[model samples]
Target: MSRLLLLSPLLLFLGLAYLLPLSGVMLQSVTTPEPGLQNYSAALGDPLVWSVIWRTLRVCLCVTVLAVVLAYPLTLLWLKGNTATRVLVELAIMIPFWLSVLSRAFGWLSLLSNRGLINSWLQSLGIIAEPLTMVRNEFGVVIGMMHFLIPFAVFPLASAMRSVDDRVILAARGMGASRMRIFWQIFVPMTKSGIVGAALLVFVFSLGFYIVPTLLGGGRSVMIAELIYLRIFQIPNWGLAAALSALLMVSIGAFLVALIKRAGVSTT
Candidate 1:
């Protein structure tokens, strides 16, 4: 009873600050445009909405795959390396988090632009007659997102890998198991949960990403979050914006549910 009383303020705050606002958004999404399912209908019926949704999913898929692919090797290193080396690698992974997302996006924009570092180096070496279109496309978006998400994927996988006992691997090797076989049959399965968790986190983070995609994606590529910003601020279409936001929330919720289910997270 004492603990319950002590927790009352936190519960009240959550109800007021988080749940209330979320409830309002849901209400507005359903109610603002004539108090019916019109907005949802429009969202479902529109091809552009579907396109944005698909693009967001595609970018997220690519980012998650890239982050995991890069992180697996890094995880092994972190798990097996000496203290100093592990610290250095971990610091490198975390450096981007210290910088603002917008700042990172701009930095990538500078590097990936047609006349930027890579192109300049190529030109100096007489490797190409013209600058490559590296920025303002899907390529730029994926690169920027991968840079941001690799650390997220790495940390979880490294943690999981570190939990694995090296003696177990040694014992497996002693039993005539090859290095590749040991890794595939033992290490990979052990780290499966962590990989799933990292992929889910990276996918969810990438889904609502705005600045990197907006800056690097140009006019051709549009994400749902950016579209929501435009609708609210630029177009002043509150109803549609709220509807889009609700859809985003629903999508995120569904993804989380699917992730938890697939990862076998126990709810009880």
Candidate 2:
């Protein structure tokens, strides 16, 4: 009874903040502009909707893979480095969190745009006659997302790496195992949970990304989130938007369930 009383405020917060809004969205998805599943039926039949969903999945996949690949080395450095090195690496990972997502998206825009610094430098050195189309495309969107997600991947990876017994690594070295052999045979296998956790974390977060994709993709690489925005704000299709929102929420919920299972989290 005491625990329930203690949790009442939090439960009320969740009811108000999440359950109510979600219920409203689901109800609107079916009941708005006349009742039935027509909105979902139309969304499923639309080629453009399918294209956006697939594109969103692809971008999320790219970001997950890149974040894990890049974060592995950084995590290793963080785990094994000296105090000063660890501080610098940690600062690099955490500093970006202080900035708003919109600011980071715009920052990437300045650096990746056709007339941006990178292209200007390349052009000045006569490396290319024209500016490269970096922003307003999938490449730019992937780059921005990769940068944002790598930090998320690193922390989980670091946690996993810390759990590894260093003495086992020493024993492998003592047995004349090469550094590469030990890493592949011992280190990576032991950290498999962390890798999966990081990948799932990054992928799930990537699916709902709006500002970064919208600003960087410039409509050329429109993702599901941006499409939802267009449906609601521009096209004024509330029913369709609500349907897409509900679908996206379901998909993310599935991924989160998988994440919890992978982490061996207790639901009780």
Candidate 3:
């Protein structure tokens, strides 16, 4: 009772800050522009909306895969390395968290733009007659998102990896299992929860990204969040924006539900 009372303030704050706003948005989705489901119907039928959604999913998938592949090795290093190695690896992973998303996006923009560092070096080296187009496209968005999301993936994966039993792994080694075999047959199975958690974390977060995609994509690669922005602020279509917000919320909720179901199954 005492603990519950102590938590009431936090509950009240959350209700005010999040639940109320979210409820208002959901309500507006159905109630705006003289009511009915016309906004959602239009959004569903719009080819541009579908394109944005597909692009968002594709980018999210790419970022999640890249983050997982990169984070797995980094997580292993953080967990198993010597003191100095662990410190260096941890610093490398943690430094990104200190930077703002806008700064990171512009940093990538400088390196990846046609006249930026990478292209300049390539041109000076006579690698190509012209600079390669990197930013202002899906490739640039993926790079920026991966940089921001890798740390999120890493920490969740690290938490899951920390829970893995070393003794079971040692038993596998004692049975004369090769490193590859042990990794494939023993280590990976034990750490699947981490992999799933990290993948879902990266994917869901990637869906909500606005700044990186907006700045790096350079209008050519608009995503769902940016589309919502255009609808409300640029186009001044409040009803459609509310509907899109509702859709985004639904998509995120679906992913979370899937994650919860998978977690339940894994535990069983």
Best by TM-score: 2
* Candidate 1 local distance difference test against the native: 0.86
Pairs of residues clashing in candidate 1: none
Backbone N/Cα/C clashes per model: 0, 0, 0
Query: What residue pairs clash in candidate 2, if any at all?
Result: none
Candidate 2 wrongly placed segments (more than 4 Å): 1-6, 265-268
Give the alpha carbon lDDT tens digit for every residue of 145-218 in model 2. 99998999998898889989989999999999999999999999999988989999999999999999999999
Please list the residue runs of candidate 1 whose C-alpha ends up more than 4 Å from where it truly belongs after superposition.
1-18, 259-268
lDDT of each: 0.86, 0.94, 0.92
> Distance (Å) between predicted and true CA of 166, model 3?
2.5
Model 3 clash pairs are none
lDDT of 3 by residue, 1-268 (tens): 9998999999999999999988888888888877899989999999999999999999999999998999999999999999999999989998998999999999999999999999999999999889999999999999999999998888878887888888988999999999999888988888888899899988999999999999999999999999999998888988889899999988999999998888788668
Superposition error at 144 for model 3 (Å): 0.6
Write candidate 1's Cα lDDT for 56-108 as tens digits: 88888998999998989987777688999889887888787899999998989
What's the CA RMSD for each of the models? Answer: 2.5, 1.9, 2.1
Stretches of model 3 off by over 4 angstroms after superposition: 1-17, 261-268
Per-prediction TM-score, please? 0.89, 0.95, 0.91
